[model samples]
Target: MTIEQEKFSGGVAVITGAGAGIGSGIARRAGEVGMTVVVTDISAERAEQVAEEIRGAGGKADAMTVDVSKPAELDRLANEVFEKYGSVRLLVNNAGIETIGYAWEIPVERWEATLNINIHGVIHGVRAFVPHMIKAGQEAWVANLASIGSFGIMPVQTAYMVTKHAVQSFSECLYLEMELAKLPIHVSSIIPGQVKTSIFDADAGKDEPTSTARHRQIMHDIMKAGGMDLAAASQVILEQVAQNKFWVSTQPEMTEALIEGRIAFLRDQAPPSLHESARQLLEA
Candidate 1:
């Protein structure tokens, strides 16, 4: 039972991290598709601003502040949405943070923060919203945002990669469980290749050793130069969501080879180093 794009009309979409970047792009697109969009973010002001933009464009939208890392806050968000809207047709767990540094060198606090937001955030959303969705007996979809780094590796980005890999695994398990239960709910793991976003701003500003700082800067530059536009990427993602696709890759051609290479390496075959090309591009 695949959901068509028209099914989104008059539905409710709750998007976390909708204040900026790819999350904001998805919120705006949801509004355009005639869904009542809930723009949620840790930053109240940014959430409000995105909501206002949607409203100004003659779309129904509301803003809510939510720190997805907090389970209680996610519960509150679910309650508010259910009380006001009665149903949520789309739940996007898109809130995430990035930390840079080797696994051993990165602070424990950073590791905890990344795991809480990137992995636990998705879990909290599922725990809070899935029951309501089932009770409502509505066809719904949950899209958990992962990254290419989930399958590929990069130096000095252990924390971010670890969380994304977890998201990929969790999303797959959720999909399988839902399928076995014969539920109307669908799950998708969104694997996005560098979309133009401010995800690296903190890394860029970090007070790191010169070598680490330079590496971070290189990554920022690469993303800025080669990343796809956020709106375009979000459109691709939403289309896949509507079709009930399990694996949503925004840049498949670029990522497929890397994923294949990883598999080959795991089989004890010679495979191209995942980050070698990225490093070469940066040097060039």
Candidate 2:
């Protein structure tokens, strides 16, 4: 058996945003690896559809409606999961939304939603669940979704990019906290590079500035053309998680390149500039 199966088989995994995109892919992969997967999403129908797919395939799964933007909701979810399963072996804070617009042009509601879901969601997910995992005193894993955007700068995607940067920093600090406490809980920052997901769907950006439609479509096209397959990326992410890696990346080369660019920018105190591709996309 592979390390992933050896480590995660017969465990319970709780994943947020498992109705679609990377979250759903990881949920399916978890079920395939012999875990009982709890698939949570804001949309009850989407969550149940994924859960049914897993169950139909002879894997174990359950669906629940969860809005990760609320801390109280996450607390309730943690309590319910622990009560039902006795222990949770994996927790993935993977629910996030992408908002496309010039920072000033974005609506107040969109800005708040982006910040609450992308940043606070991950924070509260950790806060609400860690205590339970600690009390259980069993080895567990927590993976937070940090994007390649964490290491770079973007203009129109300011809201989403900032949240990713926060998640990356949060994960770094969380890893150290686990080490200091000598806990069996492992923390991983999942940096995905262009994974094929519905993050940039037109309907998802309805709340953003109307002028952002072109930019949003450009990004959606780019993702469709070049992003890695969702299932493949999920496999890579979970494998690294099973190995207890602190930095789990679907595309290591992309992560390395972004990190290198970030290092140079910091070392030289360079003014932020858009890449050629980004310029083309934004200007299109």
Compose the digit string of candidate 2's lDDT tens values, residues 4-80: 89999999999999999999999999999999999999999999999999999999999999999999999999999
Candidate 1 lDDT by residue in tens digits, 32-58: 888999999999999999999999999
> Residue 163 error for model 2, in Å?
0.2
Worst 10 residues of 2 by lDDT: 275-284
Q: What's the CA error at residue 163 for candidate 1, in Å?
A: 0.5
Error of model 2, residue 272, in angstroms: 0.7
Candidate 2 residue-wise lDDT at 281: 62
For model 1, the superposed segments whose C-alpha errors exceed 4 Å read 1-4, 202-211, 269-275, 279-284
CA displacement after TM-score superposition, residue 118 of candidate 1 (Å): 0.4
Locate the minimum summed-lDDT window of 10 residues in model 1: 202-211
RMSD of each: 2.5, 0.8
Give all TM-scores, in the order shown.
0.93, 0.98
Considering only N, C-alpha and C atoms within 3 Å, which residue pairs clash in candidate 1?
Answer: none
